[model samples]
Target chain A: MSQPASNAKPIILTGDRPTGPLHLGHFVGSLRNRVSYQDDYNQFIMLADSQALTDNMDDTNKVHRNVVEVALDYMACGIDPAKSTILIQSQIPELAELTFYYLNLVTVARLERNPTVKQEIVLRGFERDIPAGFLTYPASQAADISAFKASIVPVGEDQIPMIEQTNEIVRKFNRLVGKEILVECKAVVPEVGRLPGIDGKAKMSKSLGNVINLGASADEIKAAVKMVYTDPLHLKVSDPGHLEGNVAFIYLDAFDTDKAGVQEMKDHYTRGGLGDSVVKKRLEAVLQDMLAPIRARREELAQDKGYIMQVLKEGTMRAREVAARTTDEVKAALGLSYF
Target chain B: MSQPASNAKPIILTGDRPTGPLHLGHFVGSLRNRVSYQDDYNQFIMLADSQALTDNMDDTNKVHRNVVEVALDYMACGIDPAKSTILIQSQIPELAELTFYYLNLVTVARLERNPTVKQEIVLRGFERDIPAGFLTYPASQAADISAFKASIVPVGEDQIPMIEQTNEIVRKFNRLVGKEILVECKAVVPEVGRLPGIDGKAKMSKSLGNVINLGASADEIKAAVKMVYTDPLHLKVSDPGHLEGNVAFIYLDAFDTDKAGVQEMKDHYTRGGLGDSVVKKRLEAVLQDMLAPIRARREELAQDKGYIMQVLKEGTMRAREVAARTTDEVKAALGLSYF
Candidate 1:
């Protein structure tokens, strides 16, 4: 579905917390989708090192190094520097200023009510002594979007509340200041909210030990595919098998181009004829085809790490100009313009 | 009493909120004292427009204009650009970054317990809807001090809690980061916490209609002196009078250089021999002597407003270098340095 013609080309801001390298789940869920939006919208792919350090404060050296790794992953996954502006969060001071301004628009009570933050706090087990930075990240995210004048934010269903918070700040800022200083943003919920892990877990994550990196080699991909979860009930080669909970079928549904052939295989498995080994081999072939070009691109770019860093530096410089101009307008709206 | 090292002058960080022009209370309590500190220690005076906008967000135009006014006030009051670094707060984005980092070092509960903020909330009558900026200002103040590695912070006795809050953050940051990344600032409480209003009120403020502007002309000064409060019980010239609660004596104690003469006059008045008019005339002469050169310098500087702005711009640029360097060191310590 597309928006109305009167609506501007939705400016999109989507990024990853650079805790580690991007993985296959990220490819299917967001990164690959972002590559498609590059020519269609004003895109900003950020390396959120500052946000990552909110939880990884004690291990900031890891965060610092991962910023480059994540940027490389974005390039390897087909996010174009010519179309999409990739920025390091720590390099743009305007984002920090915008965050400070938006902090006033939110309350402690309202921040505590954020559903995503609430769940993450529980998941992270920071019940009593939660880091203030982690709690206020939603406000910081609002700043990131509003700083770029981003009108469309691509996020999962779990992150819809973050968009709500951003729009709330936009409305409040405009109303309080008697001007449309900030643009309201919409949440674009992706078709697939999450991709399951190789272990058949509900989510793919670094901590889960099931994520396959975007830059994984062909051999590595094969090994990972070998461990892909299949039906536990099926014992014999000719045994009637269920394909519903089989992770191999899920991967086929998400990544395969020939859906009809995949459906036929699934039906054959359920009809008491096909074996799990044949299905696993076909699923592995489809995944390899999907990741082959990406892996090649990652390898080509990884040869000269300096070139990747240069791309980031150039993108950051371009991003900073836009950010600075937006900050000036914001400061003007707030009557903070000095000259 | 002085510090242990007699040759070592205390480093001071003091500033105005830049909401309005410096008035008589500001002149007597802080501005006059800042002039002398230029010769003694490393003095960093700031025009705190960002902090001013916490409460005055609606009046940003005023804050923007008053930044120059406050800077001019500093220069006119003899805060030498050669000896003191005068800067604007919002111009330095590093302060915002430091504030963000310092927020992690402080707790919401600890911020809520700040007595100064509590009193301010009551005074501002923002009981439940206290702006988050207002609540977190102590942390921002910590950034302001720690950004400069300020060793002495000149403040009133009522602001002791704010100093304590800054030191707490300093200690916490050092402990958590495992490095002495911040410096602890001592509060240099002035002998006179505040100057009483002309009407003998406990404090002089712009809202109280008792302030005399530092830029007041001779006629304005003469007219303001006439309103100075004296002993109400001394109905006749010969009647013995009380001087303890008198506003005129407070000003004399704070401003007058002829302490022996002023003491003798106070004794005469208490012994039922001196007239209130005589003491008032003496106080007027002493104030005019103190204010005459400042007013003349202000008049001279006002004619060349461009020159004053240039001074401010130059000082702001110099101050930014220090702040930027300090911020780089801070980011490096936090391992957020992109470079």
Candidate 2:
């Protein structure tokens, strides 16, 4: 069961739902990690348009348009298309086939018990009205991961249960079929954790209007920074301000290159005299520096929609090859290989 | 919206889970109608091997073996391969793809509310532990029907909800995607309804050990008839027996050639003096007469597994063409037709 880890390059599966453009939260969470991972791992970046439709079924135009937006985000963030397979989820029919097979291995009770799915259902106010696709997406996610035989899935802390569910399916499938055809994936939680909303909420989301998209222009970036939440009670510049739960400090901690300056600012604020405007100005400058190049690349990529579509088309073909190989193995295991 | 009744042949979709050989119950409920329907419509007979895994996930070998058993049953029952397509559901990848897409249109609450699925959950003792595949199967069935653009689906009374669910998805997809890519199917409920088990249970199922297989030999037919439930109070031949709810009379009503003789026998039994043994013997003979040719045909077909496989492979290819066209339309409607 143990392959020599030193010899084989481990596979990493990661993707985003193409419901909206990539945001600063995405950059801090998974996109940035994907950039460097291309050099070391067998990486497959999926534009999850199908999974996006799980909840956004009525907003398919958004999903369709965001496929390119997400691709542009990846290209702008230095994720070399040549080094990674950037596939569209719906384009790989094999994933849907595999998902159908994997769906059998999971129980409705288990899906209901999935913390991420459960939380999302409540968050979306779906309660009992959650779409079957939305509830069963963990199985689909498992299929997506196992189709490429991914050994590592970079996910958030909330998505750990999904990884557990994937491994359970892998084990159940292998045990029942008497063949270890699917690989179990480990959740590689990024060190940066979650970047909070500009409103100081725990999550940065488009629905909450707290997100600064990676593709934001200079004006949009400034406007978003101006709305950043800070010490509301600290009315006077000389008043001692709360450093904890402050969005400005948090953004600075995440994006600002000047660590010593950030600490000095924090110390002055805690002691007495750092103003919100001064701190906001510094945070805005840091964000502008980080986003300026990405925004420019996105604009350039937008001009060549044909190339992005080609990349996805070619990558989807490549992904289908891998997924088809896995599905064939699965079919053979289950004695469904009629051909 | 209404296509002419004369110009185009309406399509009918029907199938069975390949869990066991077809039984007399299946014959009375669906198979007999399917045979006659071949001339009136374009028919697709699917061996639902994939759908069978929703509950029988650990029994792949059973599913594999029964696929051939089901094909043999179809052939033995006079389902002409030339007039109707005999497809294995798993062989058509487009069905799974379509299922994934339609799954987005149905909510979990709707699945939970499906009467057939609800009853099945209780019947299978699944309760909260229902397999996700089982819960989501209505969507899969919708896919199976719509992939062929099937206008009519022949099902039992209990399956009316399934057809309704299929129509809902079809309407939802066509409405949301702004394209009439899918056709809603009408459920054609057969008049015979569910055949009772030999033990007098309302449903005759293979798992209940009460069914006579369509390919039962004369000896098997005799043995099955001997165990048929008769009136418990009719201990003596002269004792008055209940005509209704008697399994022997039910089987006679279903299979006996002489309707007048059967009616006379029923009257005699209700009026007393008709022995249970006498009725059982008559049933045994009638069943034997009906099953003999089917048994012979099945035995002959059983001798040619390669031919059966070839038939399925060819039928699957044909089925794929239809499913692929539908999926392509769905993709184009969803704006996923990148090519």
Candidate 2 lDDT over A176-199, as tens digits, reads 887778898899999999999999
Q: For residues A1-339, could you state the per-residue lDDT of candidate 1 as single tens digits?
A: 223267556678889899899898898899979999998898988898778877887787888889888888898888899899898888888888877777777877788789999999999988777766777788789988988888889898999998999999888888877877678888998897798899999998999999888888888889988998988998987899987668889988988889899989988989888988898899889878888898888888889888887888887887888788877877777777664
| Candidate 1, chain B, TM-score (2 decimals) | 0.94
Q: What is candidate 2's local distance difference test score?
A: 0.91
| DockQ of candidate model 2 | 0.74
TM-score of 2: 0.94
- Candidate 1: which stretches are off by over 4 Å? A1-10, A218-223, A226-245, A271-275, B1-11, B175-181, B218-223, B232-239, B273-275
Q: Give interface RMSD, per candidate.
A: 1.8, 1.0
Clashes of each: 0, 0
What tens-digit string does per-residue lDDT give for candidate 2 at B1-339? 535367678999999999998899999999988999998799999999999988887778899889999999999999999999999999889999999988899999999999999999999999778889999999999999999999999898889999999999999999997777788889989999999999999899988889999988788888888889989989999999997789999889999979999999999999999999999988888888889999999999999889998999999999999899989989878877775
The prediction achieving the highest lDDT against the true structure is 2
